[model samples]
Target: MRRLLLLPLALVTLTLMTATTSAAEKDARVYEMRVYYAPPGKLDALNARFKNHTLKMFEKHGLTNVGYFVPVDNKENKLVYFISAPSKAARDKALQAMGGDADWKKAVADSEKDGKLVSKIESRFLTVTEYSPLLKVEKGAEERVFELRTYTATKGNLGHLNDRFKNHTIALFAKHGMTNLIYWNVLAGEKGADDTLIYLLAHKSKEAAAKSFDAFRKDPDWLAARKASEEKGGGSLTAEKNGVVSEFLVPTDYSPLK
Candidate 1:
């Protein structure tokens, strides 16, 4: 299996799910989930079904999606996917609703009109840390976004990543209009809380996103600082375990910034 290396910076065209609630939480969370697949050759039919029938069902149901992610270099052994939800309770509500939605049932039936989508699909939920600031984004944010950057780390490297982020990149991004959130270590995927770091930047639109990176990448002082920290950490900028870079977009149902 080839490693998923490069990060994505495009608008993903998918999102869904909804629920009834009385009070909103103090801090909304960007609940993250990873769905793994069976195998490529065997999954063709299932894949077709998702593109055709199931994707619409999810939209029709109660889950409000932010975006979907495909590992940069997916081979077969391991596969990864992403979704965004407002809160854990909301997520639970959506999942419970799934158990009862007729559209989803029909979508599943029509797709598996042949067979199941996968032999097994496992998923985990995540909470966005308050400090990163992703949950605060309102619906209008889609109109202005920045980068969707992910930093992957192994067991010993999280401390290093944290230091790098706090001391430099975080500030640079903020200065450059890179908003819409912070860092997340894999909390519920394969390695759960031990394998990865994930986060997205919703900048002031794609053009601004391009300019922000250009300025950051071109600054010699910034480059030197990054290099110096890397040396002190005894390695490179990121730990690169499952170094995956993914892309995503907002859906109408759950966007907060409108």
Candidate 2:
């Protein structure tokens, strides 16, 4: 009789655990990375609008601001930022509501009275990878330079590329003094969705980043993993030309992640 009762209790616990996990997955946020290109001298005005008006407006509508950044070199006058919502449907609803809000419209008009603040906008929706840390609202312990990396996998090799990272690369990164912040895959229906892996890493500085990568590349474990994975994937996993793109970014004053 005790065994029978134990079996039922065990089954009940298992059911509860599965249900909880499902709920957590359902509640996970989908993130959006947006890049706004400012027309020449308008970058300051664009940033001012975000600082003075837009961030609050976004919070009021249930959108969570992640971080805002500008390229370290600052050649293009681009503003890069992240935002997230509970789910894609919720994201659409919040954006629509914000778009229609009277105050939002007014703020946009006022900011752009002289000229349009942004000349071009590029947006991509990304889903967090299984190994990535859930982004928190808390800031880092120290000021850091963030590097955004975009990897384009060779045709039909994305799976193998992800396998390498999941099993070996992330650990080696930490061993070499690189802090892995978040990793993502572009959502289906988006350009590069099938071939792109985008992730962010925080470094002590550009010099630190360079030093870290140099060590990482020379690490025996990393070399073995890379060789094995490439062999399994049939040649290099990434495209031959521009396979990897890296950009160093500095956090804006109000960026939560910094």
Candidate 3:
């Protein structure tokens, strides 16, 4: 009789665990990052269309605008933006709906009357890391520069790279005055899923960002952690060439993040 009762309790616990895992999966959000290259003399027009029409249309179709930015020097005439959805399926559905909407069609037609504003576009899907801070922008926050950093792990060492960040690097970054904005993993089966870590950091200025990194590199704890991780992985976790890439960006005038 005791065994029968215990079996039922065990089943109940397993059921509850399954339900919790399902709920967590259901609530997970996916982020999309898109980069647009504007045609010569058309960058300002592209920005105007987004600021005036595209943003509102995105919200109308159920997409959440995360932020919009451009590089500090504007040499490439590129626009970078991020958006989020409850899931990839939801994001695709919303985009399809927006594409078919009459207003969106008209906006595109009107904006392109002179010429095509955008020359090319690149996109990637990302999911937040478990150790990342809640991705958000506080209302009325002061203006700041942002750094987008991408780390490419050496073959067979991506796990080690993630472990180092989860266990040591993030805290040390905070200790040196860098505001950890968000960390992301490229979705499975994507180009970089086997070996990439992408994250964003906010700083008071580009000069401040440089100084903060200088300090972080010299921190004894960081050096020790790097040594230990490399030893455990049997070599350097990151690739020897182009292992890390960084780009500094400034918020657009209409960006929510700034």
lDDT per model vs. reference = 0.52, 0.84, 0.82
Show pairs that collide, candidate 2.
Answer: none
TM-score for each of the candidates: 0.55, 0.88, 0.88
TM-score winner: 2
Backbone clash pairs in model 2 (N, Cα, C under 3 Å; residues 3+ apart or in different chains), count: 0
- Maximum-lDDT candidate: 2
lDDT of candidate 3 at residue 196, scale 0 to 100: 87
RMSD value for candidate 2: 8.5
Q: Where is model 1 poorest over a 10-residue stretch in terms of lDDT?
A: 11-20
lDDT of 2 by residue, 111-219 (tens): 9999999999999999877666545555788889999999999999988988777667766666677877788888878888899999999999999999999998998
Residue 77, candidate 2: C-alpha displacement in angstroms: 0.2
Put down candidate 1 lDDT per residue, 84-202, tens digits, no spaces. 56656666676677768887677677767655557667666655442343344345424653244566664466666656554555555544445535455554433546545667666
Query: lDDT by residue for model 3 over 56-98, one digit each (tens)?
Result: 9889988888889998877889999998898888999999999
lDDT of 3 at 51: 97
Sorted by TM-score (best first), the order is 2, 3, 1
Model 3 C-alpha RMSD vs. true structure (Å) is: 9.8
Clashing pairs in model 3?
A: none
